[model samples]
Target chain A: MRAVALGDQTTYDAGTLTVSSAEAAALVADPALAEVRVSWASPGDSTRIVKVLDAVEPRTKGPGGGGIFPGFVGPAMPQGRGTTHVLRGTAVVTAGFLPRAQEAVVDMSGPAAPLSPLGTTHNLVVEFAPAPGAAWEAVYEALRNGSLALAARLAEAALGATPDAVEELPGLPDAGDRSLPRVAAITNLQTQGTFKEIFVYGRSFGSIALPTLIDPGDLDDGAVVSGQLGHPSLKNPTWVFQNHPVVAALRARHGVDLLCAGVVLSPEPVDATNKELVSAHAARLCKAAGFDAVIVTKEGGGNADADMALKMDALEELGIPTVALYAEMAGADGTGPSIVVPPTKATAMVSTGNYDERLSLPAMERALGGDRVDVAAATALDAFELPAAVVYASLSPLGWGHLTCQEAS
Target chain B: MTTRVVHYINQFFAGLGGEDTATVPPASKAGAAGPGRKLAQLLGDDFEIVATVWCGDDHAAGPEVMDDLLALVRAAGPDVVVTGPAFTSGRYGLACARVAAAAAAEGIAAVACMHPDNPGIDEAGTAPVVASGEVARQMGPSLETLAAAVRKVAAGEPLGADDGRVGKIPRRNVTVDRTSAERAVALVLARLGGDREATEVPLPRFDQVTPAQPVTDVTTALVALVTEGALVPDANPDSLESARATRWLRYSLDGRDVLPAGEFRSVHGGFSTVWANEDPHRIVPLDAARQLEAEGAIGKLHGEYLVTAGNGTSVGNARRFGVEWAADLRRQGVQAALLTAT
Candidate 1:
């Protein structure tokens, strides 16, 4: 029996380098090379090494044509230029030696090159095949047979085990039926800075009727995706994230529990004075909206200055939980964490966007499983990385993990 | 002495229009007509019909129409005003209440005679002499009651304690506490003749019932089969329809198993089968039912879902629909039924 070694198989070939049973046995004895990728290499064929999986050569034309090839082409393969090839034969690696006297039987033949090559000397065109350990079928079988611990790890990672699992509160109690406090006033926040435009994100905005989940790490990507998705109901794609009606409804019906009333301060190199004015106006708007907690997601693509610090101080003085999202560092070192002030109460904040609502339900489900979701934390986990979870948390009864048990009760 | 009286009727009673006229408006004239003369004769020299006003019921009930009617009553300078002893006719009763309210606002004494079953009695309160009996023949007694009420006003006497003859009018001067439970107790006590100074209202304690334990996990949760399957001894028991309470039925399914979709067939006599046929999909349980079934959630269809043609359905009929549908759904182990109201 012959032993074969596996690593990245894109560089290997099957036509050259014929292996005897003794060499295969010797290779198989090493623990590190347990997962073998068999390839054919033609002896002394240095110029052309056919990689079994390289059915199609990379196209050099058009945008995004050159890069690492995408894996997995099921039934619906996209139309493109590429060579079609079939597998030649299975090269088995074993732990026993066969003397030169015995002939080897090979099954599975094809016109293509070996899937992956081990060395990079030749422009090896390797056809792709799953390594022994990396095959999905093998993994699935292992899982079914209880040979894999991945399932347990996944179950552990899920939010099902929390002591007081967060659950969605039943549909908001009927306003007419429940004893609700009459809303005296609804204030619309307008940004007064020279920047004039502040991009906001939240639920019920954008083109998609449903919100996309966002984890903190994916905030930038989430924003881009949300903007690109654009709400089907909106006329202007950019303005979709700035839905004031949703804010008004949230304030009127759900009260401060569901929204964060705040403003964004664009970083310097834009307009320093305008940022201060916008910050002041935001504070006033918060008071008007009857919100005492404000979250400020600092605008990207600018340097953080004293203005950012001033805005934060002003918000803090208003006696509200003030959080700054994506705050760049001040000074020469350029190092500082994004600012966050943990809310002491179940404070409701009104947001134009910043937080996505689609992920609220799932996040709430996870929260119910005992995850402490910090709404104020604009960390990667809380904003864009796991946006769906963020959205779920936002829509949960506890108001996007900002709610404590006492408030929920 | 001939005491001047103004009679106000709506467009319908004045023969000017129908339901369309009910929404038209209030118009006035110098002297009494039709029923106004009948009222004058009943008063018999003691009262004279000085003016008559006919308005659409909708107008008379509206703010602008009421304002116009009040101006007319003031201009007529009638010693008193008399509106319909509106029978069980709801529109007529509503019109009568509006006119009476306008007259009272102008400080002109007014009386509305209505049957005990007339909804106007409840609406107009005790200010109008809401006759306890039927409308047609009770005119004689209604007139006598109106004449006496007018005489009391002319004699400078505060209107006497309500005799159940007239319905009660809401008095702005009466200061009652606004808390519902406290108000309920006070109202009950006042009816019992408890003196306001000595009244001690006892508040009722409301104990919150604990909610049932939620299903532990969606995947492993046991779906209890609540269908009237082989679990019961009798196939069809004689159950009293009115005595049933709404219940929640739970069902569980292993991963990815589709449950049977529950069928909803309207069986109540209140609904019109005509509309149901025109748009069968409107009544069909498709969207909501299919979604629930696909999610492995409980599939429940309340027996005998009530359907009614909203068009031209009287308030009485609508109320009856609500009551009957609620009762039917309650009996079928339904916690809540998806009601599609047109």
Candidate 2:
């Protein structure tokens, strides 16, 4: 994987990208969308992007037209292979309201800036509006596909440019390393309803069989796409899946410290029966693979915690050590219990942070995506103090950033 | 301007007497008492210990006496409240913690100091606590910690994380350099190596409730339908919030045989609610309940149904709603309820 840092440029020159709004709209033309507006929000800009649907880092694979998101944009081929050029420090942000969507914001610079990675990235904000009589599902479908196509087009700018850095992600080593501990990862994907699901290779995880296994490399190549628009702080965005920190962490010490076994994707359903069923399936798969330990993390809110607890309990009961990661909605003061459901046997857990921590955001010089932000009262305000949960991917359940919940005396 | 402070202490701390005076009632004196004088010196001129309140450990332990003592403290109207340096004294520590907690609850800045393992630490609640030593020998240092904490709270500054100056309150979020992924890997490695590393989030204990007795005569019971599915009239006359709702609303089901499509809609953000919109009975099950009523298999259904959106609501709010809902249902002679959750 190679990354080319994007700087201020009207054209692709010296690691800089110049986006043409006209060309970008043409690239993702769809009948579901009546209009598509392209704008930019660079770092240090006094800007806030509201109603965020999803964010994707621009990247393309190889010197050819092959893209990173294989099934969505390029041919249906395995990812995490060959030379993939990433337009680092830049993101293609999809902004639009989905039916029954909650509020999500990203401040370019302020007290809320550190909450989301998009706050620091050079964002190409793509705002999509539905056409007359367009069904919500059709509009959402177009938004997801159009955004991916736009991301691929933007990443093309990095194809002929010089890369700032190159990273090598090696495949799994031979199973002959008996001394090393074999560790794997389980990512719980939110698949409750429309606009609240994750697609693996263009197919929703809910549609797949229980405890589906995917190559860790495919995740890096953008096989996992996020469609969840529930809670911003808890939901996993597309970018996090592409640059999975947990997968990277395991891969970092793959040959030396431990064996990077593989990654399993589990669907977090709403009801209790399905939650337990999926958890059991995931645990059985891990046990069958002879995993020494597994790291479990979830996507979305408290509902996922129930899924995490069941998964952890199933794995621990099967004699596999599990480390679970979660974010807390422990009220505004951080005094409430972090998890809605606690695992009986799983003791090792990592907290991403408290999503309900209050933050005071100052009025920005400019606002992008929308004029009004949907919050408690769904009003337009220049400055306000609200929960950190409103920020996009601030307290990411996947632990993409460094924010954490710690005890204060 | 100097910040005024109300100081709280036990009988021994006030030098009023020892064990025998432990049963004495609450008393107050103007300005600094025994330890308050030292605390005053440590606090410097920026703070004034305007009043000192003392109570017998035995008397303070009583609920009514504690309330009276809190009233006296409230009358002082100090900028901040500082309690104890209770050290290893269990009863004294408990009194100090309760006093601080009460003062803080009333919006007064409050801090308490005690040994970490003091039995009273559990009663500290959300009050900020400073760490102290196990014995009187650590009085000077403990007072110093308390004085520092008073200043910070008085100035509306939060206690710093990981600083020994304060005792544990609850978990707070902070931005660190390493992501939770790195931390998870480290924890995994530690577990694999047979090391017992503490989890960042302590396991929470949930309260258990015994099931209510089933209705003895279904034909004579008044069955109420309740849901957390946020099903409401199309206009939502009560304007119930779509999510994180703090209040529940009741709608009349007086003359309707069915909750027809387009007449009612679900505002719940947790689920798709498409089918529920097509037919609200999937959520409230009102149609089936009505069929049973018409067939004389059960008593007549209640005239109204209660609903609230459960998504993103805090446990505290949910508990309050449950308590209120139970009272309301019982007052209306609701024999049993069918509560559905989203």
Which numbered prediction scores highest in TM-score against the true structure?
Answer: 2
Name the weakest run of 10 consecutive residues (lDDT summed) in model 2 chain B.
B160-169
Tens digits of per-residue lDDT, candidate 2, A308-405, equal 99999999999899999988766665655567888998888898888777888888887777788756454434888778778888877777778888
TM-score of chain B of 2: 0.54
The alpha-carbon deviation from the true structure for residue B154 of candidate 2, after best TM-score superposition, in angstroms, is: 17
For A137-256, candidate 1 gives per-residue lDDT tens digits of 332222111201111111122222222232221222333432332221111111222111222222212111111222121111112101111011111111112122222233333342
Which window of 10 residues has the lowest lDDT sum in candidate 2 chain A? A1-10
Give each model a TM-score: 0.26, 0.78
Those runs of model 1 whose alpha carbons end farther than 4 Å from true positions after fitting are: A1-409, B12-24, B122-126, B135-140, B156-164, B169-342
| TM-score attained by chain A of model 2 | 0.94
Clashes of each: 93, 2
